[model samples]
Target: MTIADSPARYGALSRFFHWAIAALLVWQFGGICSEAILGEDHPLAARLSANHTQVGTILFVLIVCRVVWAILNRGRRPDHGPGLLGYAARLGHFSLYALMLAVPTAALLRAWGNERAFAPFGFPIFAPRSPDQVVQTATAIGSNFHGEMAWIMGVLILGHVAMAILHQVAWRDGTLKRMT
Candidate 1:
């Protein structure tokens, strides 16, 4: 089918970004959980934490591209719904985008403040900077904020999934078909 025929569904680029981000998020969350379960001093814990940082950095870059794609492809409509439902869907999407942006943005700031090196595949986000008192302070504050925001994102995601299931099972709507 031509692109126009599937306007309610995501385009090729959008779908790629969506799945890619989803995979990366899973990796990130898994790493976080692993690190928490294992002690910080454990070698496996260190490895998982490092993987989380690297994957988070990749997610940041992918999210930037996705935002640009979303803006450029803004004309494609979402599947139809009641007016209020449609508006709520849009708002939910915007909140997802915001969290996607905020999480990594905070991580980046934490990296900078803590003089932490983000070497993903030998590429660095910034040149290693000298340790600063402010870095520790900022890192503490930013890390707390990041953790809280992550919980918020988790709740929103659960809500989104529940609504999609409701649409599929209760209403027999095709809302989940677009993303899946």
Candidate 2:
């Protein structure tokens, strides 16, 4: 397959980004769900959660790249449609992209404002924030909406998968093939 997208289908790069992000999202949510099930203090939960920051950091970087690539190939990609389904597809995708960025952004902001060093994979990205001065805004944003928005993103993703299945099964439109 080609590296750049074409009207008929997504190329190698797009597929890589799509599947990579999807796998990482599964890892991310799997960790959360596992923690909830096994108890946050369980050894299994701890093991999964230990890499959360690192994975999220990687995801943020990749999502940024994905956005840029998508824009570069926007004209060559498949169209959503002209009707309501198309509009919903457009909106759902936009929401997914937005949430993909927003969730990690909230975590990064929180880490930046944290009293401890912001380290992902043992590399310090942000030095410790001043003990005397707390970034209330950043903390509040992270605390208030991070998890909630993540769950909302989950719902959007389910819809996305459902649409893909619908296209592949019911509609037989080969929509799933665009990024396959």
Candidate 3:
């Protein structure tokens, strides 16, 4: 069941998902940044890539939980910001959810398409098909779209962070407080 009223504060599950996602994003950003600076051949780059994959898998699961939670608790309003700002916030959030779902789904398809073994915890989610047609098609589509989406996500995320900083520093708004 979901709460229809405005939340007094984020519930325990909401808070956990929010903070967990935040931490994972931080780790992801760090890994991405390090990879850009250190080059792909560096030891740190390899480690970061492994870390990125593991954390991304966790993010995929967390996002699924978050979406389910959000669907169930549809009526609870978040703390309000300025009118235009609120619209932007909503847009940003929607974009975030779209990218979160799309990116991972694409990556999974790409992996499966290549007939690559996905041994997350030593369990295979999909069995190998002798002729992997769906995976092959998905991998081609996913590679192109995923790169484009990644760029879009990066811009939106930067904007989101900028807005949060603006709220905290310039406006002294409580926008960041709700999530923080």
lDDT of each: 0.76, 0.90, 0.75
lDDT of 2 by residue, 11-109 (tens): 899999999999999999988988989999999888888889889989999999999999999999878988999999999999999999999888888
Give the C-alpha lDDT of model 2.
0.90
Decide which is better by lDDT, 1 or 3: 1
Model 3, C-alpha of 53: deviation from truth (Å): 2.8
Error of 2 at 159 (Å): 1.0
The TM-score, computed over Cα atoms with residue i paired to residue i, of candidate 3 is 0.85
Candidate 2, residue 100: the lDDT equals 95
Choose the strongest candidate by TM-score: 2
Give the poorly placed runs of model 3, Cα more than 4 Å off. 1-5, 79-82, 129-134
lDDT of 3 by residue, 83-131 (tens): 9877778878889889978877887777677666665766787666556
Distance from true location, Cα of 36 in model 2, Å: 1.8
Q: In angstroms, what RMSD does candidate 3 have relative to the true structure?
A: 3.0
Per TM-score, what order, best first? Answer: 2, 3, 1
TM-score pick, better of 1 and 2: 2
